[model samples]
Target: MQNYIFEIQLKVRDYECDIQGIVNNAVYQNYLEHARHEYLHSKNISFKQLTADGIVLMVSRIEMDFKRSLTSGDTFAVKLRIERQGAKLIFFEDIFNVSDGALYLKAKVDVIAKINDKLSRGEIFDTLNL
Candidate 1:
């Protein structure tokens, strides 16, 4: 099984930062969310489509490491990678960094695909294979 990765370039916004001129901790989660959506889009999958097919993707856990501070007007890159864990869940990793490749935050997420409130029992990743 091969894992998939997606990279996105992002610019820090003024509103995303705090009085200290650094990004708020909660914003790191937002960056991870954007990368995750981009990854799904690259696979030709949409959350709406998945819902229509009775599939719900839910985050089970998240672990984040903040290595550096990001300021407003700073540009950075977000990289997302996903690996199959079993028939029901997938593990995801996301990294946020400066345009110069300086690391800002690293996050790991576990997500599961569900149908009818139960995890899909088939080849989960294959369902969205592009």
Candidate 2:
């Protein structure tokens, strides 16, 4: 299967920041989650469907490096790429940037797949069909 990449832009909201107006570290997870959801949506597949099929795409690990802080009203673009995928595992990478394309973060996520709702040891590549 061919590799897939997706991107989206989101504006930092005041409520997502701390007292100093800098976006909270936890908020970066939210941005990543949003980008992930959006990328899946583009594939015409949803987590609900996967669950119904007795499959679970669980995050096994996440690594994020932050280079800059984002404040309220700052618009940032997130680029997501499917680095690797299989029948029981998937790997992805992302870059978060500003309007001028100034990158602020780089993240990698590892996902493990389940069968009959149970985690397995092998890789799962079913997601590539779409």
lDDT of each: 0.76, 0.74
Error of 1 at 23 (Å): 0.7
Clashes of 2: 8
**Native-structure RMSD, model 1:** 2.8
> Which stretches of candidate 1 lie above 4 Å from their native place?
1-4, 87-92
Error of 2 at 37 (Å): 1.2
Candidate 1, position 21, lDDT:
97
Candidate maximizing lDDT: 1
Off by over 4 Å in 2: 1-4, 85-91, 121-123
Give per-residue CA lDDT, model 1, range 1-130, as digits (tens). 2243677888999999999999999998888888888778877789888888888888878889888999999988887666666653444554556666676777788777788778765466665772
